[model samples]
Target: MEKKSIQNTLLMGFIEDIKLRYKTGNIVEKFIFINIGVFIASLLFKVIFGLYKTNGDFIFNWFALEHNFSTLITKPWSIISYGFLHAGFIHILFNMIALYYIGNLFIQYFTQKQLVQFYVLGTFFGGLLFMLSNSYFPLFEGTRPHLVGASAGISAIFIGLTTYMPNYQLQIRFIGFVKLWHLAAIWIGLDVIGLVGSNAGGHFSHLGGALFGFLYVNQAANTKLNIWDKLSGIFTSRKKPLHTVYKSSKKTAPKSKNTDLTQQQIDGILDKISKSGYDSLTKSEKEFLFKQGKK
Candidate 1:
């Protein structure tokens, strides 16, 4: 009975923890959780199937993006599914790190829906490029393996931000300060050179994602409208903020129902956050910012 009670308590605590993160955490956190969750699920399936003496390659076959167009007809979901699938630790580690840094930067200037669109569409285009190239390109006529990993999605994000803010600079260890455009150039250059290497499909997919990023930035600049927003309402569920009503005293009614900070004040705080990042905020400021978000 005691063990059962302890287990129940732990489960409840875990549930609450997830709820809290969902309430307060940003899109980047959610994306990371999803990717990690999928990776862990894959590991568990591998272990379980191993114990049962069954092959677990079915999971990869179903989820990971394949090169052949004929195979994709049966598993169309692989276009986006492959973005969340990673074959190994190093593959996921580098991808997740790039996603974290680039995603955080992306949120400063764009909405969550835009970020989701970039990731989803990036993977789709990457998969499409891989399939077309494998089918048509004389270079990869004989060999075309399955594609898996978050590299294409991560590439889209990093290149998107770099294109949007080309002049931006970041301080790197042993490298001093480097411009965003320079970093992007290096990344694309490496991928271009890597096309002749073992993972040519992967490199091509990365280029496909980078192409989307560059084009997105150019189109957004010219149109002053987010291409992703056109289809956002169709795919995304919107959560409206709740309004709290309060009773006024008989003696004097409040000038404004909201006792919270003004729009100007909030804008100032946001600017500060954008310029210095969230770590620069004081304890009280952080609390206020959090409360404002909840409101």
Candidate 2:
């Protein structure tokens, strides 16, 4: 009996470890969990409601029309929540597969915070565009359109990763290594085609998210203010002081020949450069000036 108890405990521990791995692996795993959990919940809802259709309107039916509308207006959380809700098993399966692959690529280089920022921002903007298109466009007029799935967010991730690492290469099973930009071009081209054709709203949403992703990576290359970092700073600012304290002692120690120069000293060197050409300095001084400029 003791042996059996030990075996059971070990089994429980293994299961817990597996759970933690999936929970904490990356943004991809979290996305998969959301999709799978929603799918299971959707199945349960179907069982209870006796509804056979997987139409987007099911959100309205299962939840309520008012609740759905409220989600659009008062609570914008639905932008993300609706991504998890799917019309069928295949709908989520493809999305999760794409997300897993693209999300893995993103997380390899970017922080988890960046992944969250891109995903949430992409989903929000995508939903906004979809709603706008459905509301105003003649193609979708007179019909209450409901969208569910992670394609828009996934598309954003794919576009963002490609933009950040345009020269990066990937190898497919049958195809040889292909440049990342090539893949991004093809994906965006398909969305553009879809924008003017059928499923216009869905395609438009994908474009909105994709555009954000592209702009995000481009701006990130030049600045430190990624959407996620800005969002975090807002919340973190509540408890933090307006300015950080840098403790400096008043007493000055003797400077050694190898000691690093102060900013003022560096500025003086630059000022001398502005007056006299590079040839005016000694070899060691020239080397020191070059090193400072590099910094």
Give per-residue CA lDDT, model 2, range 75-185, as digits (tens).
Answer: 556777766677777877888888888898776555666777778788767777887777666777566666677877887788887765576667677997787789889
Distance from true location, Cα of 255 in model 1, Å? 34
The segments of candidate 1 whose C-alpha lies over 4 angstroms from its true place after superposition are 1-8, 221-224, 228-295
lDDT of 2: 0.66
Which pairs clash in model 2? none
lDDT by candidate, in order shown = 0.75, 0.66
When summed lDDT is taken over every stretch of 10 residues in candidate 2, the lowest stretch is 240-249
Specify the poorest-scoring 10-residue window by lDDT in model 1: 240-249
TM-score of each candidate? 0.74, 0.66
Q: Model 1, residue 159: what's the lDDT?
A: 88
Local distance difference test, candidate 1: 0.75
lDDT of 1 by residue, 64-89 (tens): 98889888889999988998989988
